[model samples]
Target: MDRLSNLPNHILSDILSFVPFKEAAKTSTLSKHWHHQWQSTRNLDFNHLYFANRDSNGDVQLQPQIFIDFVQQFIANNNSPIMDKLSLTFSQPGDFQETVEKCITFSVDRKVKHLKLDFSDPTWDENDLDGLAHPMFDLPQSFYNHQVLESVTLFSCKFDVFGFKNFGLLKSISLGWIELKVSTVKALLANCACLESLSVKSCWDMDSLSVCGKDLKLSSLVVEKCHFLDPSFEIEAPNLNYMKYCGTVVLFTVNGTSLEEADLDFGPEFECDESLGDSLYQSLNGICPTRALTVCTYMLQVIPMGEEPTGMEPRLNVTHLTLRTAMHNYEQGGIRFFLNSCPRLETLTIDIDRSRRICNEYRPPFEDKFEDLWRSSAIIFRCITQTLRKVEIKGFKGTPNEVYVMLYLVNHARVMEKLTVITSSEESNNRGPETFRSIAEQVYGFRKGSENLAIEIV
Candidate 1:
């Protein structure tokens, strides 16, 4: 019987596509027929540089000639069909213009379906900028010839204004620290009619134009730290379902048939400005007019903290709620405003970071001057009686003020089933076991009748 381990060449080559090139190369010693089967494999993955030289921190530098020789030899030696995917990394400090061009050429020639490159050198200097000017390494006509190329990932690479004019069938793209002109970005998106998922991060120099396309069928779009994108830019895609935006006030317009979830983390550009919030509110209204929206905002220093919740309407039925407040600014009325606004809120998570000030001291009583302070301190969740179930408190200290907040939750919330207190043991911000024990004891003292309630301290 033929050994299963020694499968036919076609089957063996198919399996080799999943493993790294180096590991597949080791199989050559098994038999004469298996000697060059690795070269014919359809996928080439080069992640062994770090694995091979873990102890050497100086640098795992690979000469341009070494890479050129390997690719040329692999293509020449292969007698079977061309490769389907090519992923490579060259983090060396020296100029690799020739090597980079050759790699791109091989992908075009082999009809690679997926190409990923991590060519960024964090330690690179002005000397390395010379390579960007080389014609061979720049965007070429061959890139547009690879009709089967479905996805591409580029890091710290320069592209022409029309770099994506050829990728008409492209489905997904991820770019990091790459510079592209405003018109180039718009034209590229317009060209990728089938592009579904796009991620752009830390591209500081990108243009400020809004993105829009007609035949675009994107489902997930994530933009982080791409501050150059327009704040009012509207993306018109009916098929998009999930989106996440952070570090910018950019608004997203969802015209899709089904949008299940969306997360927005908007911070003001100016330290004391509320304009970003107003812009975000207006942008969201334009995108999801009739749909229910779950909103959570991180209080940035520049954006004046909202005393009352914004964008509250009975038309948008918000279900899940979370409020993360600065330790010192967490007043009782802030909690009240949230409970009153989100009437349909089902689950609420309140995270309080109290590493700075501890408000356990009590002032002398009998003064009418402390009315506002008392009302603010009494800002707890006694009003939220229905629909609220879970309460989680992070960085909980055993202070009277914090304990009062917990007690208020237990006393008021009718459907609460879980109350968790998570504390750290680090000296600077550690909340000792004594604090936990006190909070747990107080919870049990008040919740003796409620068997469904659970209080865990970790």
Candidate 2:
């Protein structure tokens, strides 16, 4: 007779979807009408950590046997044959291998479309200097051959790739901290003909990385921080529109097909190679005719070595370029080189936000040499006089150098309409509201090339 229980099946299922399965199953005790409603739910999500109640001392206290029994019983009682999504996360899998396998089988049998499995160890330090290791759970071979599967994600697990079969609708795949063979990676990628995006990060146990999607719809690729893999890495996606790489300094061959945007982050620890300049130039050439580019400060070191301005073929046709910098004086030379090479550039953004990037990548505390103007581009380039319209400087802290750049653009950019030097939430608090007024007065007081130019400081 409860008003909540009187709701219709569609409405009840919608409400229950927000809650865990254990809580949803409790509705059966409320009324006869709600008894079997939980059995027909389509989205199945289970987490061992949730059921494994903690003790007074903050340790994981739930019994493994109890979790296994509950999971096995829950799947057996559910009647839905077509699951839209299934996600399972287990804190520890050594003692519960059968439990993990059974849950996967249950979802696979019901034609699950989207699947995600994570086996992060509960006891391990989340931020341990060393990263995650392989988990004990073994995914069933049937998971790879499922015709109805569309997207798959696996984390911190080991699997044999030799059994992978064709997936008709698989469009997206994301793997991290996993172990597999080089041949297996190639075969799996080749099999997913309809795949549109693939991401692999922090994984190990491979000699060479070769991804071939010649006759497929693969368009976006991102691979990052796979330290153990061999130096040799290759990709054959002609239609790739976006790429982001953060690791070693190997030359990536793109088969002459350009990207709309490329974000390259050779990690902070990357040591400069003898061919650093050549590798950097080749990558830009491969993704030439690009509209946008975001490069880390470390990778920009070789730009001033004469590998640019002429070595670049077709030159970069970038309209929007984002340069992540350490705000170091040395990196400014490289930034100037890029501006000269990309003649079509219309908008330039300089970001000094190092909190989100790797450690040691960005030099701390704004430098004091800004009062001297260092060696900035004083010659208002042709792009600034003709095409440059907007300029944004993120993480603005009223540093003298940052203010100088703002004033430079305001005075030189003939066609620039608006210039923004915005501060993040944390930065805004650190720099009180008075800082904005000072910044605005400093730039707006100058006689700009364009009368319509507007300057913003926040």
Candidate 3:
């Protein structure tokens, strides 16, 4: 009786799912029954780590003969075409252009349903930066043409030639640290009519990225740290469920009328001609009006700067609100101006650094008359019509001004539920644990609320 043969089919398949396709294929030599078992494995992971070395400088060098022989042997040994998940990470220097191309060809030929390529092989030095671009790999014109490609990830690969049209059954594509033309991006979206999720990270030179599909069902879209594309990339997908953009600024118009969630990162200097801030707010209201919103922006002066926000109709309700503020001058006017826009906000998280004085700290007889100015700022303005449930204050340092703002929230918010004060080690605390404890006790000393506010000092 063969020891490996005793393992259940599902258990063997699960084991094969983790091992590299080449290794899985080699396991066939264990027995005649195992010969076809490896070929029947649905997951393939072609990694070069088993055949690579690092030099003194930590640069990776791969054994070409070992890798090449593994690929050839695996391809020839695995008689049946049963590849499902494929992950190939080449960590060596110098081009395995031909070898890489052959691996992709083999996967395509075998109808590999999922493909992930991380080409960190330092060997790709363009003969000339402007050399006529060609795709590093090619597939059969009808390759995987009708086969379902569930998930695909391409990192640092040339996508100038073949794209989504070659795989109409693609559900998700993650382009990480990739540089491709606008046309290539468009081609992928157009070809993959049923694509549900697309994530692009650190890809440069694509600002005006556009997506158009007829029966498109994009659920999640995340673009992070990619730069230099026209801000107004037209996205015409109706079923977009979640969208997140971080570290990159866009000045483009989005047409996702059915968008449910959005996380946009913007700063002060980011100027939008069409008023991106206003457009975003309005667009959110138009779709998922009551959805939670998390926006981070640096303070530009006593005035929170950006495009002068276009007035919005008070129709939407915000569930979660976070503000990372920068104060150029310690005037309460900036915070007031910023908070004035978020009327229906229920939960508030603030990280503030302000030099402005709080009014309660004012002394009599004109000695500290400057405190009156801080009191009269927009913060104390009686303008909130909605109920605020919770406020979390991170990096809360015991400043008279900071305490004043905290007091204002405590007083004004009609239905304040809880206020959590988290202080970092960097914040100067002369009394250490005693100081934080005393500060926590004194936070709500000047203000009143739901009587359940909790302050955690860390």
Best by TM-score: 2
Q: For residues 1-458, what per-residue lDDT tens digits would candidate 2 score against the true structure?
A: 47877778778777877777678778789768878888666777777766777688987775667767877888877776577878887767777777788788877788988888877555654223155554546676755657788888887766665444556788888887666567767777766678888888766665767766657577888878765456655666677788888776656666534468888887533455335666677766665666888888765555444344222456678899898875656455566667767778788998875443333333422243443443244555667788899888887666656666666677778888988877644445467546655665576677788888877777
**Which digits, one per residue and each the tens of the lDDT, describe model 3 over residues 1-458?**
66668999777887887776778878889877787677567776767776789999998776867876776677777665567777777654135556666677777777788888876434543322223232333322443443667888877665534445656667888986556567877777767777889998666667467776757788888877665456555667778767776653444455644765566554423443334444554434443443555555332121222244322356345556566653222333334544565566677777654432222321121222324435443434332335577888876666666565676666666567677887644535454544655665676465564565454444
Predicted structure with the largest lDDT when compared to the true one: 2
Off by over 4 Å in 2: 1-8, 11-81, 120-136, 160-162, 256-258, 272-278, 305-314, 355-377, 427-446, 454-458
Reference-based TM-score, model 1: 0.65
Q: What ranking emerges by TM-score with the best candidate at the front? A: 2, 1, 3
Q: Is candidate 1 or candidate 3 better by TM-score?
A: 1
TM-score of each: 0.65, 0.78, 0.63
Our tally of clashes for model 1 stands at 4
- Clash list (residue pairs), candidate 3: 94-123, 206-229, 207-229, 207-230, 208-229, 208-230, 231-251, 231-252, 232-252, 330-356
RMSD (Cα, Å) for all candidates, in order, is 7.5, 5.1, 8.5
Instruction: List residue ranges in candidate 1 displaced over 4 A.
Output: 1-85, 91-94, 108-111, 123-137, 160-168, 205-209, 250-259, 267-270, 274-297, 300-316, 322-340, 349-383, 390-411, 417-458
Residue 304 lDDT (model 1): 25
